[model samples]
Target: MLIEVRNIFFSYLPRTPFQVRALEGVSLTITQGESIGIVGRTGCGKSTLVQHFNGLLIPEEGQVLVEGVDTRVKGEALKAIRRKVGLVFQYPEDQFFEENVFQEIAFAPKNMGVEGKELEERVRWAMEMVGLDFATLRDKSPFELSGGQMRRVAIASILSMQPEVLVLDEPTAGLDPQGKRLILGKLRKLREEHALTLVIVSHSMEDLAQIVDRIVIMDRGKIAFDGPIRVAFSQGDFVKQFGIFPPVVSQVASLLRSRGFEINPGVLTPAELAEEIRVKILEKKEREHAGSKRGNWSVRPS
Candidate 1:
């Protein structure tokens, strides 16, 4: 396992009356090159759980092991562990402080002691990964860029570290459809080309279905379900209880199944649902032809 969360239990504001149990005996594992989605309603501890992957938060009871190194260990061990996991918070663009785009993207790698031509190459590589041209956007002010470009800059800053695992919280939040598609599409290709592990916390079921292979559902400070994307979306009744919507196609399939139509609830994409409908229609037409040929039809009066 690249990372493992072994029966973790965590609470905020410990020992105070305001203490809130954020994680409750939660356990999970992530393999290298895996793309997983962490989803739940608001205040469901999704963000709190992902923070532990990079050693930002340690479990109060159990342990979070990243590449066999416990995040609870401090000093160089912890720093090394964090270097492998890059976290991009929600509204990450808001964290930008550099005056120029190149400086912004190079900030993290610079802090890690990379310098000179090597640092410049890292910045250029990261910008290119996010589809930003180094020459054109390098000297421009990050704050002057469009919202989508600004978000890309923030993401590149993390990528400059060349982390093995990339964790993003609400990555596409508050973006227009075009902006959302741009970021997600770039990330999809980046993960494949770099063989990087990706974990995203998202509220958009449709978006998650397009990019993630596994779905982890959290509820009430605990993991409710962790399975293949289709399996998680297949449980309409269960997910609905937690106010988590499955993919639109899954929802449509379930509605059809409930109406006595022959539909497999495991459908996750529009193409799958469309193919199922086509097959059913063909079967219906064939049955109707056979029935018509059986005997002379008698008209029934209503």
Candidate 2:
């Protein structure tokens, strides 16, 4: 397992008047090279849970284990663990102090003792990974770029460190369609090229449906569903009970099925739904043709 979150119970402001339980006995296991999506409503502990994967928030009761080592360790050990798990928050802050893009991207690795050609090479590699040209963007202030570009630079800062597992919280939040695609597309390519394990927390099932293999639905500080995306979306009504709507395609498929069509229940994409609907249409045509032939058999020569 790449990460194991074992029966963790965590709360905010413990022993204080504002105490709130963020996670209660939450447990999840992520294997290497697996793409997983965690979805839930606002304040449902989705972000809190993922923070534990990188030692950002230690569980008050149980523990989080990354690569078989405890995340509760401090100093050099914790830093080493964090290097393996790179986390990008929902809305990454704008880089202000860095003179330019190269410095911003190099900040982390440089602190880790990377310098000169190696540091420059890492910065360039990270920029290219996010589809940014180092030569053009290196000297530009991140604040001067568009919102999407700034977000990409923030992601590049994390990528420059070359973590084994990538954790993103609402990666597509607050973006237009094009911006969301730009980011998600880069992530898809990175997963293919580097075989990086990804743990994505988002409310967009439509987007997650396209890339993630598994879905983990959280509710009220606990996991409500943990299974393959197909299985989880197949039971549309069941998931709906927990306030989760299936992907748009799945909802359409379910409606068609209710109306006597044979659309697959777990259809996750428009293409898949269209293909199944076409098959159903062909079957209907075949049945009508057979009925016509049967009627003619009972009629005269005409």
Candidate 3:
């Protein structure tokens, strides 16, 4: 396993009145090259769970291991695990501090002791990974770029480490349709070209549908559903019980099914739903045409 979480439990503000349980008996295994989506309603522990992947949050009870090394390790060992699992927070652009795009992206790798031409190459490659033009944006200040561009820069900063797994929380949040598309498209390409493992935490089922193959639904600080994306969203009622709206496409498919249309509720994408509707309509037309022919009256008596 690339990452293993063995019956972990965690809480905030431990031993205090404000303490709140965030994760409970959470066990999961992530394989290399797997793309998984972690989702739930607010306060369901999605973010808390991923934080353990990179050794950022050591479990209070159980253990979290990345590449078989426990997260409880400190110093160089923990730092190495972090370099292997890069996490991009929601609104990551808000964390930017460097004066220039290149500096912002180079910071992490530089702190790791990379320098000279090697550092430059890592920065350039990371920029290209996120669809940013290194030649044009390298010298520009991150604050001066558009929201989408700044977000890309933030992601590049992590990518510069060349991590094996990229975990993102609400990667497409607060962006227009075009911006969301740009970020998601780049992610899809990154996964394909580099075989990068992606673990995305998002409330947007539609966005998750476009990227992840598997879906893990969290509820009340526990795993509620874990299965293929189509299977997880197949039952609209079941998914809604956990306070998640099925993907818009899945909802539409369910609506059509209720109205006597033979559409699959497991449909995840708009394109898939459209094709299902088209096939159903064509089948209906064929049946009607055949029925009309059978009902025709013969003129042989004349």
- The TM-score measured for candidate 2 stands at 0.93
RMSD of 3: 3.2
RMSD of each: 2.5, 2.7, 3.2
lDDT of 2 by residue, 101-200 (tens): 8888999999899999999999999999999989999999888888788889989999999999999988888888988999899999998889999989
Write one digit per residue (lDDT tens) for candidate 1, span 1-302.
99999999999999999999999999999999999999988999999999999989988999999999899888889888888999999999888888999899888889899999999999999999989999999999999998999889999999999999999999999999999999999999888788889999999998888889999999989988899988888888888888888877998999999999889878887988999999999998888788767765632244
- Counting only residues 3 or more apart in sequence or on different chains, how many pairs clash (N, Cα, C under 3 Å) in candidate 1? 0
Cα lDDT of model 2 overall? 0.90
Model 3 lDDT tens row, 23-84 = 99999999999999999999999999999999889899999989999999999999999999
Cα lDDT of candidate 1 equals 0.91
* Residue pairs with backbone overlap in model 3: none
Every model's TM-score: 0.92, 0.93, 0.93
Q: How far is candidate 1 from the true structure (C-alpha RMSD, Å)?
A: 2.5
Model 1 weakest 10-residue run by lDDT: 293-302
